[model samples]
Target: MNTIDEFNIDVRALNVLLAVLDTGSVSAAAVRLGVSQSAVSHTLDRLRQSLGDPLFVKSGRGITPTRYTLQAGPHVRQLVGELRSLSVGPPFSPDEAELTFTVAANDYQRDLLLPPLMASLRETAPGIRLQVMPSGIPNPEMLRKDVCDLVISPHPPAVGDVMQRRLLDDHMTVFYDADQREAPESLADYLQSRHIGILFATGERMALEASLSTQGLSRDVAVTVSNFSGLPAFLKSTDLLATAPYRMKDHLLKGFQRAPLPFELKPFTLLMLWHQRNHEDPAHRWLRQQLIDVAQGLES
Candidate 1:
């Protein structure tokens, strides 16, 4: 008998053995694994030498497993099943879960959705903890470097491993202090007015400004702030017009009058992003669904 270590058999070789035994032929097993027929034959030969058995023999036009191979088939299948199961995480139960997750979001998203997300989690998953940080001009590294589990933003990083879904859509609207002045009368008036713009600390303009730039339009910014939270202070009792998402009317820019933009622009969608590695994780999926539900509930 040969020592099993001398042959160095691994899970792939074991799968090949089981494939041939199940299909009753080497060629069929190769087709199953997308390998060449000779490759299957070579694996069987090494497995046969390691086990001291002629695992298969010709049976008329096809092949049949020998008595030893037949006896070991079920055990090989079980071993392979157990080895494959190692890749998956254990089961998750939100009620009993004790986990912490970080989410990257700007003030608009932080105020709009996260409060509802927290309220929902408190009712269903009290054991989980949340740590939220600013997601200004979100980048793929936030997920790749484990900085955060999720990012809520209009911009999605241009990386293949990053995945995103639109949480909700909002159109650019003219926000103004009704007591100070009314919305701009026309495109010319809108373009000429003093505008309040959001410019992140890193010097990147927000999505609305960036998108407008692509279409050869620009804002005459008399005031610029680092976040959406600061826009309200600058717009009060002033003729300054701030073009922002209409959804903000009930949240950050409450009591401000809203009117449709005088010019045509595509509606911007707020998106949620995550790393591909967590796409199938049980806990991640649960939280992701929770966030989506909150966004959807707001939409409805």
Candidate 2:
């Protein structure tokens, strides 16, 4: 097999190709790389000339990577990752760092955490860019395929090489418009009422729902929305109920009245999961610490 030496490209050129492949467009790659679109195209031209492969071709509305590009993409990603780990120079400084970090989280966590996180980054690390993606149940393939830098979810991918840490703990509680109806008084009452619940595209059941199922119980979900943000719309001014994390009172599901579940269920921990490759990376460490601080601030 041919190594990167055969391509006659430098690390910068490899990064250009990688950014293009990772983002699926020259324009988006430019944004990720903090450069102009034309500059990214020029680098791709250089890569094509050096490697004798078109690398990418125009697809319907966007672009699609060529077979050569797809085959070599993983190797290029690994090489760039290896090159980035070399800390032979000066100490790390967040203000001076210019790179993109991808985070996978659903709307609940996204709305709760990203706003404060972005404000902190804008002030302390002006050059850092956060690219957030939805994390549905957080499967191992997300980390294995280099999908994102970190995952914020209750269900961490059960992989040996993945590192996870508890960020915060919260339990589900019933949410409803008090103007419409009183809170359910028992498990039977909770099941009898119409529910407006979250239904992610991944079809992974929420931990609360899954646990209830284990006890031979389930909600009569009359309406379903993609994320927690959509719950407020259907729940307002109606006799509908929702069960979401208790912290949501300060986040997305504000103004809506909440009550504890009439039955017993253990609380779940929100966790931050990352691949083993990032265990010792300084920038990654700083990002994780910032998240820890943000989570701590929420409770105080």
Provide the TM-score for each candidate, comma-separated. Answer: 0.69, 0.69
What is the C-alpha RMSD, rounded to one decimal, of candidate 2? 9.2
Backbone clashes in each candidate structure, one number apiece? 0, 0
lDDT (0-100) at residue 18 of candidate 1? 80
Error of 1 at 174 (Å): 0.9
Tell me how far the alpha carbon of residue 241 in candidate 1 is from the true structure, in angstroms, after superposition.
0.9
* Pairs that clash in candidate 2: none
Give the per-residue lDDT digits (tens) of candidate 2, residues 11-31. 889888877886688997787
The residue ranges of model 2 lying beyond 4 angstroms of the native Cα positions read 1-88
lDDT of 1 at 235: 95
The sequence of per-residue lDDT tens digits that candidate 1 reaches over residues 78-131 is: 777677656657788999999999999988889999999999999999999889
